[model samples]
Target: MTLRIRHLRMRAKTPAGPYGADIRFASGLNVIWADNTKGKSTCMQGMLYALGLERMLSPRREVPLPHAMTSFLKNDDETQLNVLESTVSLEIENGAKQVITVHRSIKNALVDNRLISVDFGPTLTDKTVRTERRNFFVVDGGAAKREDGFHHFLEQFLGWQLPLVRRYEGSDCKLYLETIFPLFWVEHDVPPKFHPAAS
Candidate 1:
């Protein structure tokens, strides 16, 4: 089964003001091109964060990268510190014409009193069909499992299975969609020395 993103919405409450982006994608080969500091990567990261896969973006960093929504929403001015609250919503459609809306937030904390919220539903406007955060995660032996929330749902919804492959010898590590997503969503990071050649 094929999966396609219908729409994406990101919103952040900042000291200066509210900031957000609404984007729509087509079926195939959609490209987001812009000059430096135009929020191209931010948009991509927001979508990933919305799906609870931001951690996979920088797996090897000493300190895991902050949530894309909250981190970038911070006020630049240090004089008056302001806590930024952010949210991301994604709408996806399957080949069977079933549409699902997933909403994740860094501000609202309802499930398990955690700062993160992950919820989804059949349609963007329908609230009665939404799923609770507690139901999103896999619970085994009366404890939350290490499995990802959104990834598990997508796998079952699309009937796709993720393979467990070793990165190297004796490595018991598993592969995730986040690790592989970068291959398709290539972001060019040209160094200062290579700027001329890139241009």
Candidate 2:
């Protein structure tokens, strides 16, 4: 794969202040290590969300992040702050050396959650680069196949020509990213829930 992930950013606006995290990846293998529930999963989820690939995790369009990203954020002092808005952005480059930043709103007043904005250059890293912004839709019908879809945009960016596959229904269908992604990416199952009776 010629795709290189440059950066991932998650930000939230709160009355107390802004709570956010930024992660930059190196050229080679990248590893994220943190204690349980310390946002190791959140960073991965944020990248998926920014790329409009969250549907691979669920069919529902609801935000998959925890309350810390959607409803509230806790400060270092343990004070709770109400989150007014939250967003995630991922910077990526293809084999052609084309760099673009993809951004999505988790919860915001002005932007719809289903809308994704793409910058032509590395807006997160270099402010001097003048780039055009384009908007695309996800989670709705035909998002992967339609011309205006985010996945279609991504496929063009990555120079992918998905092949037709024979489904069980005896019909040919284009192999989607959700199906191909699992070959390389594996998302862990959620921790088992507690049950008093089982225990």
Candidate 3:
């Protein structure tokens, strides 16, 4: 199936008030080139954060770096405290004439309560559509099931079911979509020799 990203929007909260970054994608390969500190990585991280896959980019440490939402909202000095309220909205279209818009938000709260909104329609260009808000937390059989809200919608939209599989031998872990995303979206930090490792 063909999945195309039509647009990406990011809004950041900082001491200087809120700022936004809006991007539009075309049909073929899209290239983003700029000088150093031009927000290229920030923009890519925003898209991943929007898809609820920011954890893949975080380093394995005792205490992870600032949450993906707050990472980009820091001021130039990076000293003062700035509570970031970030939002990522993505418009995607499948080859089956189905288009979906997924919206996710990050807010400063005690419970880290994230919100997700999904919109579905016949095509990406459709103006009139139906939107729904999903609850990531659900209780089933007296057990709490905290599902990844954004990936759940993405699985349906892309018509691909992510099953539980062992990542390595004798490891009872499953491979997530985010775990394999690096194969498709290679970052610049990768060394030339390891470029073939993803394959």
User: Which residue pairs show collisions in model 3?
Assistant: none
Alpha-carbon deviation at 188 in model 3, angstroms:
2.8
Please, what are the lDDT tens digits per residue for candidate 2 over residues 30-97?
Answer: 88876677788888888888888887778776888888899987777889899999999999999999
For model 1, the local distance difference test gives 0.59
lDDT of 3 by residue, 2-85 (tens): 678788876767676777677888889888766665667777876776666666777432112244356544456765546467
Candidate closest to the true structure, highest lDDT: 2
The global C-alpha lDDT for each of the candidates, from Candidate 1 onward, is 0.59, 0.87, 0.60
Error of 2 at 107 (Å): 0.4
Instruction: Show model 2 residue runs off by greater than 4 Å.
Output: 187-199
Cα deviation of 179, candidate 2, in Å: 1.1
Q: List runs of model 3 lying over 4 Å from the truth.
A: 59-84, 110-113, 121-130, 135-149, 167-174, 189-199
Query: Judged by lDDT relative to the true structure, which candidate is superior, 2 or 3?
Result: 2
lDDT of 1 by residue, 78-154 (tens): 34434367677787777777777777665544433112234445444455675644335321221112444546666
Better of 1 and 2 by TM-score: 2
For residue 51, what is the lDDT in candidate 2?
84
